[model samples]
Target: MAKEVSCPNCGKPVEWSEQSQWRPFCSERCRLIDLGEWLNESHRIADPTDAPSEDPPPSDDLSTPH
Candidate 1:
């Protein structure tokens, strides 16, 4: 039996097999919808670190002495 999965975009049943062109998505439209979401910045991966990164301190080597 072919394994089934839900489409990430529309929650439709999708078969997980060689015949399934889009394993996670039901159709081309759903795939494009997901792509649009990514392009629009609707989906984002969470940062690994909790704290924000701090900028590096200004370098004094570039400064010319008076």
Candidate 2:
């Protein structure tokens, strides 16, 4: 059995381990298009939730200090 997922390029359905030469992509053209979209900032996902916690940086507090 093959797992299914959406094609990142055109939002089409595709299957994992599918009979495709492009594998993750539906086709070679779609793969290239996806790459171009990434380069152009046309596509983006959630922020790095995997980011590590860090100390707060120096900044002026805008509170009324009540």
* Winner by lDDT: 1
TM-scores for the candidates: 0.59, 0.48
Clashes of each: 0, 0
Candidate 2 lDDT, 1-66, residue by residue in tens = 778777778777777874866757888889998788786563335345545668686565664343
Clashing residue pairs, backbone N/CA/C < 3 A, model 1 = none
Worst 10 residues of 1 by lDDT: 42-51
- Candidates in order have lDDT scores of 0.82, 0.72
Off by over 4 Å in 1: 42-66
lDDT score, candidate 2, position 38: 85
